[model samples]
Target: MTNRLEQTKALAGEARLAVLTWLAEPDRHFAHQETGKPSEIGVCVTLLTEKLSMAQPTVSRHLELLRRAGFVSVRKIGRWSFFRRNEDAIKDYKEWMNEHL
Candidate 1:
């Protein structure tokens, strides 16, 4: 139980939380691409980097953290990776936080 609480608190960091929030409304935060299209799976790393105004590697690290927390889902298309919010997981986390803390 304490371990779970620690894990939850780890994900509450500002950058990770911001990533989750942006993913909640993907279309609004990300622009559509000509080839892959943001709607197909989620937003591409390029768009996310642009939106966050951060470098690709930095955004990739942030996405990885969000993925570990189960707040984001990734789909690999060819060589490119796309990311979207895991709504169910986010909802479950919110409920658990409400109940536990």
Candidate 2:
């Protein structure tokens, strides 16, 4: 994992934040993916790319940053990668904010 400063930086972008928001309640924001449910296996990067209207590499880079930051987790199902929020890590960040800032 990267340092907390780097992790916080990963969460600072509008697009990345949007990604996190969409992932937080994916079923509400995104349609059911053919591979799996949004709440279960996770949301596909391809779906996120379409929704965000960005190139796949850009979206993937954001997801990779979040993964390194421990703000999200990934699962592999065949050739596709799925992503979901890491609620515990998010909670920890919130707690750190409340206590420090």
Q: All candidates' lDDT scores?
A: 0.75, 0.89
Q: Which lDDT tens digits does candidate 2 get at residues 1-101?
A: 53789778998999999989998998887666887688988899999999999999999999999998899999998899999999999898888878987
Best by TM-score: 2
- Model 2 regions more than 4 Å off: none
TM-scores for every predicted model: 0.81, 0.94
What TM-score does candidate 1 reach? 0.81
Which candidate tops lDDT?
2
Q: Across residues 24-92, which tens digit of lDDT does each residue of candidate 1 receive?
A: 777676656654556557888777788778888998988887777777789988888889888887787
Question: Where does candidate 2 clash, by residue pair?
Answer: none
